[model samples]
Target: MASNRPAPQGVYVPNDDDFGGYDDDSSWEEWNPTEESIRPVRGRHRVHKRGGGGLARSSTVLGVGVIAAVGAGGMATAQGGKPPVAIEMPDVSAVTDSLPEAKSLPGVGALISDGSDDSAAAGQNVAVAAAPLSAAGVSTTDAEQGTTDAGEALRARIMEQAENQQDQADDAVQKAAEEAAVKEAAAQAAAKQTAAEKKIAAEKAAAKKKAEAERLAKLAKSYTLPVASYTLTGTFGQPGSMWSSGYHTGLDFAAPTGTPIKAVHSGTIKEAGWAGAYGYRTVLELDDGTEVWFCHQSSMNVSAGQKVTTGETIGRVGATGNVTGAHLHMEVHPGGDATGVDPAAWLRGKGQSL
Candidate 1:
């Protein structure tokens, strides 16, 4: 196709700057387009998803349209000298092909190389040019989104890392608290168990002591005092020299003469005869072979070999022989031994008190 713009019947010619900086006006005389001008791009450029997928046809159409528009603008500048309309190409979607070839108006072979002939290096160059912004370490997504803020991605990463660290620290503290709670519970359980065991032991000891006391109380029933209504004048082991022995070997119960004397415990009459200093002495032998002597008696109520019970009348208090006043003397001999022991203490052992 041919486009002719003849100057309006005037003898004026267009300037060189209006026709791709050509100094000779003859060079801009007439121009026509050829099929060779439409260069067939060998490789395809990948556009962003938001952009349409027709890279070859679109890019070809776009390049040809830009040259046509610039050519018209040059014509305007040469003819009327009006300020060339502002020719700014808005930002386009991302590309992944070699760089866009530098283009000028058609028929202006003086400016750019003839890329109508393609090669591997040129193709690589185009691919580099068409490569996404991400290939140059820029965020293609953000760039495509028209993001203007810098360091936003870096700030997001730092915040994410800090949050992770805080979460880990919280988990560690919670675990430690749980462990501490478990340990405290175990300690409390141990203390409770120890207290329960101690209480059980104390209860057992108390029961045992009560049982022993009950046993002792039962044993005191069988024993009685030798003579009631009599005053205790001399205890066993007294140091009075009024008797033949150096110390008093008997417990003296002072009483009026003829007062009744009772048997101390259930026993048989072993001896009911007199000793010279002992007055009318009576000896009783128990089933356990212990002997109790009752002396200074005015009269005996039972004969030898006779059985008697506790508290039964056996004799009368008297100072019949070698005595100054009426009284009764008592002695105890265990297992029929000739020597006697402290009757008061022995009675206490059997749960009896003086």
Candidate 2:
């Protein structure tokens, strides 16, 4: 007999337990959702039975409660200050269509395609990831090349500067050397000019001295000594008692009584007569108006108006009136005056020693 019963709202209904018991020998198998027989319909809910029986309705209720508890835990986790992220699942059908067919190997079971092409693709990806990027979004190789070029340019600039400096230094040194050479040349020229002037002056001085010597030689040829073969007896300006004056007024030449006297230079006879204290005295007047008096002469050979050349005999030496030995007294007067100069010095002016 069947009895009518009212079930509670949330309670589970159980069927009769026909199997021996839920034992440890039970076997479990994985469910294949891809199989056409087990495929679930869209927008419909259904429960499939396990082999030999269905799970107890209490067990199903307990599984639903567990799923509900897990859903509540996930909601709590979402509310605990973490934001929820949406993930998209890939289409398996599209992935399978793109892959190559599976192949069987000798030792291995069915295997997917060999990964040589995939590895090459992966290598390209790795290369892209490993490369460094610059701030301008360029590759590291290009950046390094740019750095090398810049370095080379900088080095070239430095070398150019050094070469320019060297050239400048060389120019300065060359300029200094040229300046020094110019100064040296100028100095040498000046020295040569000075030497030339000195040579010219020396030549002029020598010529003038030679001309004067020739003129003096010609003049000396026209002059002669007053008397020859005579001994010096008295000198002028000697303090003695033999003269009216306090000093000797003339030179005295001692010789033989008849020694000949000569004219000292070219002159005209002015006085040829005797005077007091001077026997046979003769006077000669030169061209320049100077007079020569020969005193104490033995005789006179020239008259008052006769001209006599140098060395011509004019008188003879004798102590006629004066109280001296055989000697001749000579006196010289400028312009035929009483005042006289030393005859020895006058004769020496005409290049005569005495």
Candidate 3:
């Protein structure tokens, strides 16, 4: 008779020894399925009640073996022994990896679903170490900003000081220029004043010299003799002079018997008289109290208290006194004293040469 049955999906088949039912001598060796150990044959087979039961048991044992192998694979992955050692985690933007708002934490947390290797654990540890470094970088940047601000302030101060110094220098220069101009003006004025003074002094000296020369020429024109027609017979203080007083006291002039005698200067007639030694005599007094005496005259024409001008004829010359011949004696008395000076020297004082 023909038979029909379904084929198994895997090649594993269980034996009775799988249930621990065989004696020691009939014990089955353990089956480890490999690629070459089991294969399916193309044949129709009959199902027996006892054989179906063995097949069912075989399927159960195979199912149990597959379960144990998958459990061991899971355990090996957990213990950090898989080929994919580094497991990927979520970034900081993910909900599970977001940074906390707490001040105690400083960095983002990583979201790890399968952290099954040594490298994954090392990456998480690196994230923890970065927190303190980020905080230190913030402090360093703030210090650098402060230093930049200080440098700007220092530069501003230096510029202000330079401007002030320039202003002071300009002011000093202006003041010095003004002072120099004032000094120059003063010096020019002083020189002009000195020059004017010198000119005035020169003019005064020239005028004084001219006045003195004119004064000297006016004194030479004022003298006349006692008699117009006469000859000098005796001089003043002659060594061999003879007279009534043992010395000749006056000058003698020889002339004709009626020659008119005149006054030599302006004076007043004090006397007209006759004397013992001097025959018809006359005396004339001047303004400064000087007196002039004319003796041995032929006759007198002037009387007392009669004023006479210079060169006025007072009497005629004649031989009427104690004399050797016809002549006139002329005598000068300063302040009416008896003695007299040399008449030649006195005539020269009026710019006349004797």
Candidate 4:
């Protein structure tokens, strides 16, 4: 006859002390054996009590254990008592859907579920999960690229500033050169103006000199000497015993008794007669009220009130009164006064020699 109770679903037994070291409080759940169950047919196995609450707790612990094993496999090393291992994760979206989404954890990325059927997207998620291992390398590459970009920008700014400064310097130099050129042009203009002024002054001086020379030439043509052929016997203001005055008052020309005397300038004869010691004196009155007296004359050729030109015969030389020898005495009276000036100097003033 068949037994009334159902047979055990699955079993696990340890050959050594590996499974016997669990604490008394530790609990396990029963698993049903199927074709996929990893159990040996001929080993000694043990059965544990099954409970609904314990089944949920055992499933959670088993999922955590599987994740930890996969993470450790990625970091495995072939050294000392361990061997190297490579971990390849399978798609687990179906399994993750049955559980609540895990909250964020420190030192681990968030557990986000992707329910899409695209194989390429699932592969990308796997690639992202592997990123934590290469985080250092990726960050180093980004930092170097940032540094290079910053250096290039700084160099460009410095070059722009240098070009601006060069432009300013060039402008200053050009302005200074323009100012210098203006100053030099002004100096040249001033020098030319000064030279023109000097030239004008020199021309005026030459003109004045030319006018003075012409005036002198015309005056010489209008005046003449008193007696042409005569010897200078006495000068005016000579002290002499023969003169009636204590000093000689006129110029004396010693000549032969009949020497001719001419009018000294163009004038009218004022008087022609004896005047005491001035003996047969003749007086000539000029247009400007000056008088010329010729004394000690042997004879008078011009009468009173006769107009005569310069160098015309007016009298003859003689020793008629108070004379040391035969000579003509001549006196010049400005404005026709009795007191006279030197006749020699008066004749010289008219461009004539004594």
Model 2 ranges with Cα > 4 A deviation: 1-209, 233-249, 277-279, 320-324, 351-354
| Candidate 1 local Cα displacement, residue 227, angstroms | 1.8
Candidate lDDT scores, in order, read: 0.75, 0.74, 0.69, 0.76
Q: Considering only N, C-alpha and C atoms within 3 Å, which residue pairs clash in candidate 2?
A: none
| Candidate 3 lDDT by residue in tens digits, 201-243 | 8877777756644553464444566776667888777765356
Model 4 C-alpha lDDT per residue in residues 36-93, reported as the tens digit of each score: 3433344344323455766888899977875676586564432233433445567799
1-354: candidate 2 lDDT, tens digit per residue: 322232223333323332222123323444434345555444445445566345577688877775675566542222234333333568999999987544444422222334566876667656555544333343355456564344555565678899999999999999999999999999999999999999999999999878766765666677776678878888989997777887889888888988999998898998998788888899999999999999998888989899999889998988887646889898999988898999888776676766
lDDT of 2: 0.74
Positional deviation of 325 in candidate 3, in angstroms?
1.2
**Lowest-sum lDDT 10-residue window in model 4:** 19-28
Q: Give Cα distance to truth, residue 164, candidate 3, Å.
A: 56
Candidate 1 local Cα displacement, residue 246, angstroms? 3.9
Q: Report the error of model 1 at residue 235, Å.
A: 2.5
Q: State how far residue 215 of model 3 sits from its true place (Å).
A: 6.3
TM-scores for all candidates: the values are 0.43, 0.43, 0.38, 0.42
